[model samples]
Target chain A: MSILAIQNLYVSFLENTVVKNVSMDIEEKKVTAIMGPSGCGKTTVLRSVNRMHELSAHASVTGKVLLRGEDLYALDAILVRRRIGMVFQRPNPFPTMSIYDNVVAGYLLNGLRLGKPELDNLVEESLSSAALWDEVKDSLRRRGAFLSGGQQQRLCIARALAMRPEILLLDEPTSALDPKATASIEELLVQLKKTVTILLVTHNIAQASRVSDFTAFMYLGELVEFGASAKMFTAPQDKRTEEYLTGKFG
Target chain B: MTFTEAAKTLLWRQSLDKVFFGVICFFSFLSVLPLVLILGYLLVKGVSALNWQFFCRVPQPLGEIGGGIANALLGSLILLAVAFLLAVPLGLLVGIYLAENKKNWLADCARLSVEILQSVPSIVIGLVVYTWLVLPLKTFSALAGGAALALMMLPVSVRSTEETLRLIPLELKEAALALGVPYYRTILRVIVPSGLSGIVTGVLLSLARVAGETAPLLFTAFGNPFLSLALFRPIESLPHLIFYYATSPYAEWHRLAWGASFVLVVGVLFLNLTAKFLTRRWRVRF
Candidate 1:
């Protein structure tokens, strides 16, 4: 069953509409990839899911995003964000925090207090889930900035997972990493989808095909095509989706 | 051009660069010469006056051989403490607001105000504080002196805090927000801590700048002779003591003035060095 649904979403910055009448349904515990060229508003769609779009001063949204059949717009934006965590394009672990502190930053920032053992368990579990536990367990007290780029990204993932959000929204998270780092993060995402629903925005068609169960191709501000990844890759219904898949144009 | 000719031109340019470097180094040394000379002079003249009694005893009568700037030293500390308490919170809040809302009309106004405040003469701030606080109370008091110093401190603290916080990438704040942290918490817990070193450096520098200010305290503090800690009473500060005794005709007072000058300069220098050290040690690298 679909866990999240976007209905007639339109997003605009100032007088320019960037996302127009886009709609999609994200399945539970499954990876959905939104693939499009740069500036096609795929990132905008992902940002809007967690109410992150409101951070931009002139950005406006008109749509109903339903999470578990509840309209997210009607709920508090902060509460909505808590339920749907987001990871950015660049790895940004808090520079002032230790790796252990970074993993539990969400709780600390939210003013939630857990007992020391509870926090320890949460940190170990989350890091393990992000596949960074063994690499950082001995050095958890070190600042997160000391980690390599790939390790920092995994630390960010662990931080997000510690909150135990129902959905994870990633905005081209591997774009800033090397090939090996990208491969590791991609593998982590495939593993992550077994526990939490994921909505990934990517420009790489191969990444979408490799990990996404479903693929949505966005062209300009419109949703051009969306279906099972295998079907969409092999037999695209729309001309734009076929062109994008075959590298005719991004 | 021929290769040899080009090589000769390059050689000429390199010689010019060396000349420029020499000139820059000479001028830098020249600029520091006055500070070194003043320190050397003060040490020579003031060292004899500095003793256990110099730190603990109040000034003596004009013909007396020994005296101390105990009251002035204590008063300076008290004024600085009061100024720090007044300035830090207000400066940090204003700075955070300006950094977070760069495009807002209120922030623009505040930025302009900070610039104007920074350029305003310190003596003028003293006069303003005198009129506002001293005149109302009908007395010169340490509170008035501290308020004047706080005014001088605000602009530096606010500007440094804003610039430091602005240098922090927007992604850091976004990272917190994306985790469902509230806006205020994101600023307090993440952004402020990230910029702590710069903020502290600003505060210390501002304190150093005001530590030796005499013109402001001349009207506000009014320079008492006896040691007093009462905030409502007139007080003697290092600069005020130096000004008062240095202008007097007694050889003994002149020696005391030299001693006070030495202490004041050393305190300012210490604050500046501590600021530099803490900035390096506490800097958060992303």
Candidate 2:
């Protein structure tokens, strides 16, 4: 079943319309990759799902984003965001917090106090799911900034996972990592889809083919093509998708 | 074109560069000369005045050899504590607001007001506080002096907090918010702690600036003759005592004033060093 439905969405910053009339449905427990070149408004579309697009002073949005049949726009933005988590391109673990604290940051910030054992279990489960527990289990009290780049990124994923959100949105999550780190993150994302639906925006076409169950190709502020990953990649219906997939242009 | 001509010109340029480098070093040493001379003079003249009784006893008549500035020392500390309590939280909150809401009208007004308030003379602030608090309360109180110093302290504290928070990447806030953290909690728990070192440096620097200020207290604390802990009563501060004793006719008062100046300078130096130490020890590098 479709977990998120974007209906006739249009996003603008001041006078420029960035995402125009884009519509798509994201399935539950699937990795849906949105691929486009830079300035193609793919990130804007992903941000709109969580109502984070309007954080900019000039930015504005129109139309509806429905999560599980409920219109997310009608609900409080903060509450909507709580149900849908996001990970950025850069790994930004809270530098002031310890590794353990970063994992349970969501619960602490929300003032949801749990017993020591419950918090310990939550941190372990989340970090284990993100595939970072073994590397950091011995040093959970150390500051998060002491972690390596790849470890920091995993800590961020663990931070998001601890919230137990229904959906996770990633915006080019591995762009800042080296090749080996990028490969590990790609593998982790494939594993993460077993627990939560992931809608990812990536400029890396090969990454989309490798990890996504579905692919949506966007260009010039519109969704040019979207289908099952196998078909959309092998036999894209639109000429633009063909050009983008064949490396004619991004 | 000619090898010898090129070598000669290069040599000349090198000599000129050497001369310029020497000039820069000379000026750097020249700037440090006053500090070194002052410390030397204070050590020679003020050290003899410092004794065990200097820190524990109140001042006596001009002829007495063992009068101390215990009252002034305690009074200065109390006034500063009160000012810090008043200013730090208020300034930090305003700073956080300005950083978060850069486009809001209230933020703009606050930014402008901080800039303006920062430039106002310390004496003028003292006068304003006197008119505002002292006259209404019908007394010269430590509260009035603390309010004046806090008013002076607000600008530095606010500017530092704003600049420090601004330097922290926006991604940190986003990361916290993405975890379903509310705006206030994100700022209070995450952003503030991230910028802690810089904020502390600002607070320490501002405190150092106010520690030596005598003009504001001259009208407010009004110079008590003995030690008093009441915030509502008049008090003696180090700088005010120095100003009064330095201008007096007695040689004994002059010696005590020099001792107080030496102490104030040392205190300010300690604060600045602490700020530097804190920045090195605690600053987070992203």
- Quick one: best TM-score, which candidate? 1
The C-alpha TM-scores of every prediction are 0.98, 0.97
Best candidate according to lDDT: 1
Worst 10 residues of 2 chain A by lDDT: A51-60
Clashes of each: 0, 0
TM-scores, chain A, per candidate: 0.99, 0.99
Query: Interface root mean square deviation of every model, in Å?
Result: 0.6, 1.0
Instruction: Let me know the TM-score candidate 2 reaches against the reference structure.
Output: 0.97
lDDT of 1 by residue, B194-244 (tens): 999999999999999999888889899888999999999999999999998
Question: What Cα-based lDDT does every candidate model obtain?
Answer: 0.94, 0.92
Which residue pairs collide in model 2, if any?
none
User: What shift in Å separates residue A200 of candidate 1 from its native position after superposition?
Assistant: 0.4
What are the runs in model 1 whose C-alpha is more than 4 Å off?
Answer: B1-14
Q: In candidate 2, how many Å is residue A109 off?
A: 1.7
